[model samples]
Target: MSSLSMASRNLRRRKARTILTVSGIVVGVALIMVLLALTEGTATQTNGLIREILPAQVTIVNATTPTGSGAGIRALFSSGYNLNQSTVAEIAGLGGVYAATGQLSSTAYLNGQTVLLAGIDPSSYPLATNGLSIQSGTSLSTAPSDQVVISDTLAGQLSISVGSRVTLGPNSTGGAPYTVVGTFSSSTTFLDRSVYIPLSNAQGIAGEQGKVSEVYVKVVPQENASTVAAEIQDKVAGVRVVTSTNIATAVSSLTGTLTTVFAVIGFVALLAGGFGVANTMIMSVAERTREIGTLKAIGARSSQVLKIFIGEAFLIGVVGGAAGVAIGAATSLLLSSLGGGAGAGGLGRGARLFSGVLAPAITPELVLLSLALGIGVGVVAGIYPAWRASRMDPAEALRHV
Candidate 1:
């Protein structure tokens, strides 16, 4: 019989042992796959959230004060520093600039509850955010003054809706009453807790009429963002500039570190599986000592004997890897489904914060990589056992039986 045929027959004779050995590999590979999927999903979701909420490619803020690294999204409610409103027109007139708008962020109270308030220009602000996407009633353009658009999460919290009259001002007890002309929904907490009003109204309310918290600028199509950001920093005095590339690089650095940590964990689990495979192969060699002697006496070369045992290990790797891929993919999808479902159908701001569910991304590369790792572990584990079986003397192996 050929070496492959002999390998197949030997494995079939020890079905229980073969199955147990493969199971170890399957578990290890599956764990690695799931970890990779989760990390990939999180990175993708975070980047998408950044783009959706802050669509502008370049952001300008006051250099005198510290702000969120990119566009001050995390500093959404802070009013510590301000930039001149005329800076918007100056940046807009610059070369390679497509659009520019200014915004003022501050705190407002709604019936004793603190909320984030944003003042945006009705015309130019929509260009930066791709429109606030009002879910009900009219936008700020329709009722520019004394009208506000509230997020669905905020709307649900205070039991307010479109056309409902609400009071918002510096304090809870004393404030100006404004009609809620529109309502909007956002999957991210950054936008969910916010209430949007006209730039003029926000300035009046915050007592910073000629100042804006930050400026959002869109680069002209086919223009380089880094170049524009550099120009903005140079031309605009006392202002800090952030570009989309900077944000992406910062995000990548964080995710790369996270991926490395997960990879080490997965590799450790897979290493344990390799040890199990080695032990199984060693035991098999011990049990088949006499059979191997018989084969050697029948003119089978040591090299041929080695090939047969290695072939069996290869088969085990292939089967285990395939099975592991299926299990891992299914488990990832199940967890994603459960996580996504849990965040829905709940009321209030906390629920809304958890509503942005990121599903696991299972790419073809991940599957192939996992399968390759399993196979490699199996082959490496079998090396010593295969070598020992090949180098054994016929008389020495046969005398034991």
Candidate 2:
């Protein structure tokens, strides 16, 4: 019989133990696959959202905060100091500037739940943001009316619709009621959580009258966005300007940290599986000492004996890796399905936002990588045990029996 055939027969002799060892490897590989899938999904979605949401060429904020540190609207408004509304006109008048708009942002309470609020000028907001996509009812009219537009995501969360009367303020008390004029869809959970009202009302609510939280600027088609952003930074001494590149880098930094952390955890689990494989191989070699001596006495070379043990380890790795991939893929699909139900009631706002956007991506490269890991671990773990079995003296091994 060939060395591989002998190895296969030997493994079948202890089927239960071989299965237990393979199961350890499967657990580790599956865990790594799941982590990679989640990170890949998040990175893909975030890149697409960055392009869709921040179409403006340049965004201006107070210089006190770091550039690109607050790429999201909520972070930008909450951290930066206010700039006077006149700054909008100054930026608009600059060379290569097509238009500019000021926005006021603040936190408001709605039925005891914290809500993000933004005040925008209907005419100018359209010029800067290209206007909100209204799913139902009409967007805010040009006049500063006491009407509010909500994000469809928030509307679903609050269980309110257009023409629904709701009250919002800095606190739970003494707030005026406004009618929901429309619901808009921004296609991202981050921006979709905000409630929009006239800029005048937002300014009044935020208590920063005559000042705006951030400025969005549209550059002329013929001009370079980088050049315009640089000019704005040089001329406007108290403002920080950020372009698309800066925002993308900032967002990547946040997700990159999470990816690194998860990768480390997965690797550690794989190492533990390796140790289990090594232990199992050692015990198998010890139990088979007499059989190995008989093979050597019957004219089998040491090299052949070594191949028999290593082949067994190779088989275990193949089976474990294949099983791990299937289990990991199935688990990722389950998570994606659960995540899709984010709009359902009973979840907290933070949980809803994360689940709403989370999608686990299982790519072919990820599956191959996970398989390679399992095989590599098994081979490395078996080396010592296989070597000890090969170098054994026939006389000593026969005595051991």
Candidate 3:
């Protein structure tokens, strides 16, 4: 028989044991594939969404503080920076400022639960609708009335839908009724829990006329957005200027901390799979020691012996990786299918949902990573066994039972 046929026959000698060993390698490879796919997909969508909204502009905002009040003001008073109407007007009139607009936001309790109510300028909104993530309903298009947009989370919390009326208590100007004209949410933290309203309407609720939360400015054809930001900082008082990039960076940094923790936890599962492969391979090596010696006695080189063993492990990894990828993909799809594709209740991470299915993106990089990790595990696990086999004396091997 040819060397290849003999090796194949020998591999099948103990089918059960071989299958078990291969199964371990497969699970390890699969774990790596799933993690890589998920991380790559999430990072791509989130970072891309940030870019779409921010888009090289600068924002002037009032820094917040805690309001200290005793007895009569029993409720918590959050100190907020309100963008002065005059400051915004001045910024809009500046030479280099391409576009300037104002916005406001406050925390309010609806049915004893906290929800964010944000006020945006509807007329100037098209100037920078990039910031609002419209998951469902229509964008804030109608003239400023008592219409408000809410996030999917808030929608779910309130169990309300578009065109429905709900009471808004931005400071309890009688918790006046507002129609839910639109709904929005970002998969990220920002939009997922917000309520949007026209600036004029919001003003009526807060009872604070001519005051705003921030003024966003887009610079014209200049890489030095910061230069204009500096100019705004100099001209404007009681307010701070921040670039869209700056806000993205700050939010990204905070989210990154959580991602890092999850990444470590995800990687630990990979390590556990690796250990399983190593343990299984080691045990297989011990059981097949005499057979390895027999192969070596017949002039099979050390490298060939290593290749056969590693190849076996690799085959197992391929099987497991394939299964794992399918499972992970199904999970992403499932999330999208459950009304997560569109509307406020959908997945906020900009995942493309089709036919009510959130598809987990399978990319080339993930495939490559899975294969590479499999080979790495196989080579690592084969080392000790290959060494032991290489060191066996041919004469002594032939004498064994």
lDDT of 2 by residue, 247-358 (tens): 6676666656756776787678778878888899899999989988888888888988888888888777877888888888898798877765555222444344455335
Against the hidden reference, what TM-scores do the models get? 0.79, 0.77, 0.68
Clashing pairs for predicted structure model 1, backbone only: none
State the TM-score for model 1: 0.79
lDDT of 1 by residue, 145-231 (tens): 788899987899889989899888978787888989889876665576788889989898899988898899887673677798899
Cα lDDT over the full model 2: 0.79
For TM-score, the strongest prediction is 1
**Cα RMSD to native, each candidate?**
4.6, 4.5, 7.1
Model 3, position 177, has a per-residue lDDT of 79
Question: Which residue segments of model 3 deviate by more than 4 Å?
Answer: 1-31, 48-56, 65-79, 107-116, 128-197, 258-286, 296-306, 323-361
The alpha-carbon lDDT assigned to residue 44 of candidate 1 equals 73
**All models: lDDT?**
0.78, 0.79, 0.60
For model 3, residues 1-401, the per-residue Cα lDDT tens digits are 54445434545776776566555555555555544554565555545544543433776666442222211111111214576666767888887887787776666645344565667787775573355667778877657577878887778877988988788775444477778877776554334666778887776666657877667677776686888888888876666676656544544454455446645755565566556656766666666777777888777887777766665555545544555555545554564355354543223322332211212356877777666665566556656655665566766766666
